[model samples]
Target chain A: MNLLEWLPFIVLIPLISSGIVACLPGRFWPWAFTLLAALASAVIAALVLPEAMGSELSYPFGNWQPPIGIEYRVDAANAFVALLVAGMAALALPWAKASVDQEIPERQGAFYALFLMALAGLLGITLSGDAFNIFVFLEISSLATYAIIAHGRDRRALLAAFRYLIMGTVGATFLLIGIAFLYMMTGTLNLADMAERLPEVSDTRAVRAGLAFIIVGLGLKLALLPLHLWLPNAYTYAPHFVTVFLAGTATKVALYVMLRFIFTVFSPDYSFVVLPLSSVLMVLAVAGMFAGSWVAMFQDNIKRMLAYSSVAQVGYMVLGVSLVSAIGLTAAFLHLFNHALMKTALFMAVGCLAYRAGSLKIQSLQGCGREMPWTMTAFALAGLSIIGVPTTAGFISKWYLILAAVEAQSWWLVGLIVITSMMAVYYIWRVIEAAWMTERPEGATRLKEAPLSLLIPTWVLVALNFYFGIDTRLTVGASSAAAEALLGVPTGGLP
Target chain B: MTDNGILRIIARFLIPFIMLFGLYIQFHGEYSPGGGFQAGIVVAAGWILFALIYGLKAGLEVIPEKAMYWLAAAGALIYALTGVASVLLGGRYLDFYAFEAFFNTPQAAQQFGIITVEFGVGLTVATVVMLIYTFFVRRKSEWDEVMRGSDAE
Candidate 1:
């Protein structure tokens, strides 16, 4: 009847349109169709502010309360993710032009159609309340993403997709097993109800087993340390557009689920007792941070370097969660949002270079700042953000994280964070130096700038870095609220 | 290229009902075990049955490769758009409680919303199955043709 009530339809619209479009003529203008659907979906998602900013809405499936019918719950946390995924897809329309034109073929419509479905799945994963619903969307997105990745021009893309499929399937199966274990214990799938029920039998082995399965399974998807093998290649060989979309939304959304389960569903107090979970997570995060950056320094291809860097960045976010402090949670959440912007901007720059030079090799990018000034400048700005330079969005999260680590008396972690960030700075500066200082080959001169379409979205993220840096109100505030919410601290008074 | 095999005829006749049954599973999900994902697989199986009996080429002729891709998007879009429509109707994100237009009662509205999304999932899965089959068959046939020509030479 009203805007707040139609939340499910936002997810449903692109979902159904993806299906209908798939059945339509692929020769038809898929870009137009997919774009319109993404835009419309964004509009609808934007309309649901009351749910996102206000409070949680629980829609009882089949008119039955939880423990009976499936439920789709929306609160401040996931609703923003719903908006981000849809908005990114919408903004991707113009950016998708040059990249897709270069990477995909005349059968681009099919790719676009699949792209939309994957978007729907990602959004559904972010928005849905039912645990099973998450698994469904996860499969939908994974299957579609694999197909999309396989459509890439290189043979490596297919291999990469296959590898991802294997790993992703294993992760999914584990998550399913975890859900099954939980279901067997509680006989309910509603997340809220599970949160309530979990505390009663928090000591049960089934619950512990389920927690382990979920942590490991999600760890794989989140690319947390030991389970991160599938990430770099998938990002590198897949279409450039895909790197942007997945980097911006997919992992962060997965992190959201992890936080949701750990804090809200499983009761963090119980789950952490067995493993000294925070310490374990911290070790992994530290490893990811250092190892990812170290690997990035050795890579010649800028795209692959960014991919490794993403792993490292993910570690920082995970580290934030590991601290078990509200400030650390805020830092992690804020960084997840900020990192997506930084990484997306950085990847777009690489994509633009890939478009013109037919390569994203650091050597080939030598003196590109002189040729495609706009694109490379955006690259440098994003790189600075990634390096956590002051006055950029990236610095805000690192600043808080260092503070959190200090507060936790983990002064060693504070040093680790700073040193790893310096590693990011080193690798990033290597690219910047090559792009700006090294001599451009004779033929490489006279390069045209990326089209306004691509440049605009790239700059939007770049601008966001500066904008959010100066005004940490939204990022910091919401993250604090989210962190407090995760801690079960009742953020009512937290200003 | 066999013409009008008995099995093909039987498959053609039964596939639609199977798909309908898949739709029923999707809608009845709240009260049952199967919902969007399972229903999707089932409906996709119907397309698989059609593709196998009539052959991928024949199935392509009927559904078309490009059309199948769009159908996948349409399916997810249906799911997304339905949620958005609910939002426009004043429901929270994925909240189906206010969808009185589709379901007269609050209980029915919730059921209606979930089913609507389930149907969207079915559409996506069905089309994905169809598209994947088309590609596999095309690739296989192309490989086969190349092999035959090489052998003849």
Candidate 2:
């Protein structure tokens, strides 16, 4: 009846179709079904985006009211995120068709089913308003993710999936415990209700313990440094398409949850001020930014390099959050969206290379620029965005982040941000040099360009990276509204 | 020396009753604590016991792989589509109040929706458990074949 009514369908359409698709016969049916599901979900999300930005949209299941039954709430922040997610899924499906066919030997249908399930779970997380329900959906996505990663043909993929499972379960367990503590303190599982009740009991040891546990749990999921060991291997060993989707969406959704919990469930004053968390977060963010970039430079595997770079990108986002101001939060949300575009494009381009060359090594890309002109060019352009080049999406995010640091009067953070962007330049140059500078091997056969199916999706994202870089209306508008909502002012002076 | 007499007789006698009890639990859940989840596991236990007594091939003949996949998918679909159906009827997603037009009263509609979704859940759970058991058991035959090959060599 209303746009808010359609929120559940955004998740259910994909969840139901995943099952139906699994039962369908034929090798192509799964991919076709996935594409249709993603497209439908994306369209629904677009229609709902305006409503979500205006006010919170909550749907209580089975006619039950909030604080008693589960609710699906969408605000400017998560709704924008949901749109980005659906858009990415729709774009990734076409590329997935070619990549999965090339990489996997059997069970294509099941793999597609898992992909849809994971999509549904991510959407569920973004839309859910219940604290415990978040855990339910988190596990759904995590379990499906483990299976998808294990679907990679590499023998090491199994190990990677197993390791992820172990770490992910521990994180989920801690999260569940945190939710339990909050429920104990507040006598409710609904996030809004908890936020209302938590203030009265904010000074208690139990509440503080709950906050500590929750942040630590999400920190693991965010892959903050020292807790980030499982990421590089998992990304490196997963199937190209699986890696692309997870790289773009999984941690970003986790970050959204962190944002929601810190700003909505627990008041910023309690979490950021009372606990002195900004200083701790600032230290971790700075360490992660440098360490992630430095290690990425030495990686021989292209996928591994990108995975480490993801760590660095995550640091920039956290650094923004650590500032605890409207501008700071805006920078964080903007970079989250920008990084998704850049990483998705980069990975899709790498998938194209892998399809033709059969390896993801830096060495394998030698002279690939000459052979696959469209894909290599896409990579180079997206690479510019990654390095914060002028007139690119990456540059826009770094610019805002620096501005936020300036607002906070932290010149050192400004300096660190610039230094990391420079480091990004060096590592990205390695790929460019390998693709453009090195001559084609003497005895090698001529490699054809990637199929149009793959090339189309890669370039669409690449085009958007530059387009949004210059025209910042949508990204800036959505992020600023979301940031103001989180901070409760145009420019918060909490710190 | 009917070596298999006890096993066959025991399986034939126990399987039907176990399945019947599972169905009883599945439908009786509304008045009691047990529901589709417990019932589904019980029903699957019946099939698993039969497979253990007989063999993998015979077990598959009873419920083939394709049928198992369809059953799993169909069960989940039944549960989800009921919620979707409510939305299409102009109610909130998964709200049984949408069914009030078809039923005698709102409470009746709620009852109908709950029962239907529970049935769907039971179907999915039972099918999935049976499917998993079948696959895990089938791997034994392959392992045996590999071991036999080594011995012959």
Candidate 3:
């Protein structure tokens, strides 16, 4: 069978498997079944790498033409992300088996069902060429997300899920209104077609209004500055497995949607000139960078601190995108992929801590460095990435972002990226020192390392950080191509 | 406990013709104002009326919680099934023109394909709304705090 033909299968594999998983009895061999399904999907997605990298593809739903039929478009940008998500699924499924068993109860089948559906929704969002289609998948994932988050053992999880629901509904509403406005103006919802129409009406009040509404709507979903109120609680309070998947994928996927809209659907010129999106992004990025760092420093809970740090990292992504340079977008996208690896490793390590010590308390983890050296080693490596160490993934993102800042000739913003990242170093260092240097307390003597179930995925992610740092060609090459496609410019320096 | 007012109002005013009109919009999507997502919302709104006016217990009697979940699953299946059916028919997944040249008509296939997914969306949205309501109202006696001084009217 031709590889191009499996475009719809990428989304279908996850969705159909989710249903099959739902039917598995609570006592059934669910882990084996779910892991097999997820790994198969990852392998299928990987198999398409050559075709996807070569050019963009559009598959019309039910044989309908565009401008009416829903389409799934696979470009280098989305294909790369789809691979990351599916790869993470393949890697993390074994870990999820035991984690879900330990954290949740008899509804294991349904939980796996929702997880696959979420994977489907995320892939659908990345692949969909139609705007409203994105909303449908977004809701699919969000509704399932609420159920999954609420399934956490902690009672506070209910409140966190409820809060997420309220914010998510608001975000969805804003996105709907924005989309309605766009449809009114262009009479189209197909993104590439909309881009063609955008130029003629760039200055129209409605288009600008649509731009403002869409950006704000997406910003809320992406957890930008001041809009990030739901993130920390949702991440920290959710079960360990949920935190790993959600923290690693959700916001990054939102960022992908935002980039798709700003660069692909609207001319970069219109977005930059009319909305001054770059400047607004710059301001929010700076605010998020410092605010997230400052708030994180005082937090005693390890997960909460990491959650806040995600906000700061998101700021760097926005900062990179706002530079409005090809290098900047590339940097942002690379960082997004890199940060996912870094956070997944770190969160998984935290999950191990919780499993052994029954807490991920920084103070309590003082001597874990020696006891759980594998996990601690993973944590230290991830932490070093967070600090932008040379030959690590984070360093690559930073280097590109700094170059983009220079291209924009904005030295002060360069300082902001540097200073905020240093703040990241301080917090990451705090955890390292606590985990390794301090003495192990009496009764904290659960000197056991995590089971193979968890260690495998965490280390996979950690090793990736170093691998991608050294072999920048894949990350940089694909991101640069995506940036060029989005900007509609030949690969070159900023205008 | 009962879905009153606009639910009933809209039920009477619009629901009567919505099936026909939803079909119309679904068909006109290539030429005019609606498609899968909007149609799905419309379909969901109808089921919402059932759950609202009738207590969830009564709602469960008609559309059980487990059943609704399965129906949601079915909607996605239908959407995917259309794609597979296309493939089976010898084109690609979702390649409608492979079915018939009627699709070559200006709006025929776009309209047809859109209606297909619209039904899918309707199924999902309706199930979601009902599921959410179930979550909130499953324990009806908890409403003593709301109605105040009595467990029932």
Off by over 4 Å in 1: A23-28, A43-51, A61-63, A442-446, A491-495, B1-134, B148-153
What value of lDDT does candidate 2 attain over all alpha carbons?
0.88
Q: Score the docking of each candidate (DockQ).
A: 0.30, 0.81, 0.35
lDDT of 2 by residue, B113-152 (tens): 9899999999999999989988887888889999999999
Per-residue lDDT for A295-385 in model 1, tens only?
Answer: 9999998989999999999999999999887778888888887888798888888888887878888877788888899999999999999
Per-residue lDDT of model 3, residues B1-153, tens digit only: 363676566655665475556556545665677765666556555556555665557768877888888877777777777667768767777665555655567356645665676677667666766777787766566665666766454
Query: Which of candidates 1 and 2 is the stronger one according to DockQ?
Result: 2
Q: lDDT per residue, candidate 2, A1-495, as tens digits?
A: 667777888888888889877866666888898899999999998888888775878989876899888999888888888888888999899889888988885788788888888999999999899999899988988899999999887899999999999998899899988998998999999998999999999999999889888887888788888778889989999999999998889888888898899998888998898988888888998999999999999999998999999999999999999999888899999999999999999999989988888777887678889999999999999999999988899998998999999989999999999998888999999999988999987877677999998999999989999998999988988888777666655553322
Best candidate, TM-score: 2
Look at candidate 2 and give me any clashing residue pairs: none
Clashing pairs for model 3 are A62-B94, A63-B94, A63-B95, A63-B96, B3-B52, B3-B53, B36-B118, B40-B122
Highest DockQ model number: 2
Chain A TM-score per model, please list them: 0.95, 0.98, 0.97
TM-score of chain B of each: 0.78, 0.92, 0.64
Q: Where does candidate 1 chain A have its weakest 10-residue lDDT segment?
A: A19-28
Docking class of 2: high
lDDT of 3 by residue, A194-227 (tens): 8888787777898888878888887877899989
Name the regions of candidate 2 deviating beyond 4 angstroms.
A490-495, B1-3, B147-153
